[model samples]
Target: MSAFMTKTLKALGLAAVAATLAVSAPAMASGGAAHPHAPKEGFSFEGPFGTFDQGQLQRGYKVFREVCSNCHSATLLSFRNLGQKGGPFYDEKYKNPNDNPYVKQIASEFEVPDIDTDTGDAITRPASTSDHFPKKFANEYAARASNGGALPPDLSVITKARHGGARYIYSLLTGFKNPPKGLHVAEGQHYNPYMAGALATQWSGDPHHVPVGGVLAMAPPLKDDLVTYDDGTKATTHQMAADVAAFLEWAGDPHATLRKKTGVAVLIYLLLFAGLTYAAYRKVWHGKH
Candidate 1:
């Protein structure tokens, strides 16, 4: 190889090594426990042609409402959003989600803090399509106090915010296991192979073989038959986890279907335009060659 190419390859190798160190620094500094990669899931919205399953999204919404909503707040969500095109509750008759009857009913189920207009006294009124999902606690401090000093994260964009998106959530929810023989789990802490934290101090195992997972305060939230689906689909723990993850994915990227469709249309248009351009060029210079 030429001297220039040899130098370039060496520089690349050094850069890659540096990057590896940088990424591993946190895990090394903590407990030498790297976060395990979540196994890939077969989502309905997986590929270029994949579209979301509306029924699954609806079931996911139910799971969130019945369970996750109690702790994690989806403050960015509004009832109207649930009825928008591609949403779980979308209806052909209701182009304006605000006017969607199903959305209106769901909104009414929650009471939101408000003030009496005449007296200015604090009161609460039934929520409307315009209101965002209410906070689970009055404030952040309250949220922490209620949950053993661990602040539940806002799940509005959780799928996008976390690595591996929906797959990570599914794995974490189902990945809880009994701590290994030498691992010491503290009060309020649960061992989850998918959660990230330092386990070196809690581990009494071989120094070189610290556990592959970390501890989390939140316990596994799903159980078999914990939720009764309106559509009568069996609510296994795995099913609920998958459903909720899919719902959160849709909530985070409600326009994904549209975006994918638009990309396909653009590709088709470009292909047709190329063929037409070739035909036009041939016709214009039929005998010139």
Candidate 2:
């Protein structure tokens, strides 16, 4: 009721309103014009209880190796990582990936460029379990030069880097289609609705027509039956997209399962501690308050 108290309450109310707006601004901006075609898709790793499907992850890896790897490089992933716990080959008999025969075979298939210690010259040799996945292009300049001036992004953490995460990747992979009537697609540009670079405007000059966005440099990378799944799962376009998205999500955060488990354990401990503290407080204050 005092003037000072009234001013203090008003300041607190304004601060609360400002905090709410700051929190909600990102949500609003994310749903705005830049991402018109971002659609949510059901993922096995969506919720707190969600876990990565090992089979799907394997299939996704195959899709990536056969298709996406030609353009995008997952430099962070190593051949041995595929055989590690929480990965596609986690159940292999050997605990050490280097000792796993399957992992060894996979690593041997790739020829890695190495420097010859004896002759100070570059040489190519079979990749070892220790080597990261080989990059298709030598560097960013080479990648951009090959892809019509647009550099192919690395797949290391693309799922986490983009908005909508797995769902956005899935949608973009499957969203390629013929441009709508009156929409003129430029040469060397592909039409993809879900791509952040897709443009909604025509090429013709019109003052009213505004540029929406640019076109994606990458084309529709996934196709039906592109990769043969060892598990007998049909390799449809949608299936490949979903599988690769899942795999990318895992690659982005290999320790997601452990993190979730730790979170649950901490939550349980906090709940038990709160209950014990409340019981102790009740006993201490009994018949006193």
Candidate 3:
């Protein structure tokens, strides 16, 4: 092949590679932009030495019960889990949550549906410690039907389910806002920068209607001083979001304390073993070299 032709081919290949990268650059940027609003906040249970603030967890549970529970369900959690060791309402004297009065009281507040054996008819009974958290709707279809075709997601393990976990939850809870000018939010859909749904509308007329991020089905459920904190911590929206995020993190990983403890113990053991091994090696090789 001629040198000139070879050089031309090489130039074309380089141009093609550059063009490919250029085309993909916006996609990569857009993917990152999707989560640009998720602010990473510090949590009490974040580091190795971290632990859940019992008071915060209790406050968060209150928020969840009053607000989020109206739609979402924590199916993996039971009333008893609330009063278990390392939990918010744990009682040292009543390690078994069944014996915990607080647990029983919380359980009794909810009525579980059941079928009567003799009557063969559905009946509602007070919830027990063993009963899982009840769903607000009977099923998915019912949930969607009630909420204008938007299904409220089950919050069991939600902290683990999302990409950024607790921080993401906190951000999302506090991130709801009006869409920028020229952006069209559809009817029944609320604007949330951190959620994953988009509003439906033709974008030809509006300059800013360029496929913005997803719309939240649920309205902004939190507000300033929404829940009166028993501890007198100012009930700011940020505070509530943080507390609820922490509580959900615990709900998703109830054994986080034990896991961290075991991890610390193992690390200590490994360090001691390493030191002892080095000492023995020095003793064995002393004066030999």
Candidate 4:
């Protein structure tokens, strides 16, 4: 071939390679960077007049106890709290949660770390009503090492920590899906659209149409029939996720219901006081104006 013809063919090959790279190169933060917004879920305790669904709370607690406690901890909670007023297991008969038989039973089921008084050595003992929930891992480092360098966040206050609160938790638990074609998921990582993260680096498809969502170290934690509900609520994955999310929300703000109730009372008092004041003002000004 003539030197000019050879040069032209080389140029064409280079152009082809460049086009291939543009189509298949790892696209960073383009469409893949955009996080898909999760839709809001309605809950019993939402509006100013709203109250928590006692049955839902009870089921949620069950889900947490049976499944979530395996890897996540709720240090902020004491078993006795379950029997407190407005708690999941609250009973009118047991005014004091510490004395509630159910709470005691639940507490006794877990062995908490303690020191043997006689030997002054670390040991495990049956937990009491006052004891906080046992941690799943000894420390953050241990938690990370055990779970591919990712620490399972404490569920006690997770609802407060995340932006969408309970709804966010629900979305994440149910958001796991097969990644779009051309998306690269590393070993031990999974795709979840509800999780806030940039997946552009893992996207090997169209730059403008990269899939939404970020890579998560946690695999799908919820599945159908994962936890059998005591109340006989069907244990679908959606129900489990919703229940656990509700439980976590309550754990985060155990006093939230009480606070809302208090606000209502305060508003009522202000309204009554204002009405009394208006009557008094009318009486004082009667026939004097």
Best by lDDT: 1
Q: List the residue pairs that clash in candidate 2.
A: none
Model 3 per-residue lDDT tens digits across residues 1-289: 3365456556655654564454222112132225532234567776665788899899999889988898898989988989988888999999697899998999999988999999999999999999998888999999999888989888879977776677778878888888766666778777766665534462445554455556767888899988888889998888888888889989998888777777667656655665575577668877786
Better of 1 and 2 by lDDT: 1
State residue 249's C-alpha deviation in candidate 2, in Å. Answer: 0.7
Which sections of candidate 1 miss by over 4 Å? Answer: 1-41, 274-289
Candidate lDDT values, in order: 0.81, 0.74, 0.77, 0.77
Model 1 residue 170 distance off true place after TM-score fit, in angstroms:
0.9
Candidate 2: TM-score? Answer: 0.81
RMSD (CA, Å), each prediction: 8.0, 6.3, 12.0, 19.5
Question: Alpha carbon lDDT of residue 29, candidate 1?
Answer: 15
TM-score of each: 0.82, 0.81, 0.80, 0.81
The list of candidate 3 runs beyond 4 A from truth reads 1-41, 197-212, 285-289
Better of 2 and 3 by lDDT: 3
Ranking by TM-score: 1, 2, 4, 3
Q: List the residue pairs that clash in candidate 3.
A: 197-214, 197-215, 198-214
lDDT of 2 by residue, 1-289 (tens): 3365456556655654564454223221142223522224567776665788999899998998899988888888888888787887776577887777878888898888999999999999999988998888988889889999999989999877877677768877887777655567878887665555434345455535534434576788888888899999999998999999889989988877777677666656655665565577668877784
Query: Clashing pairs in model 4?
Result: none
Higher TM-score: candidate 3 or 4? Answer: 4
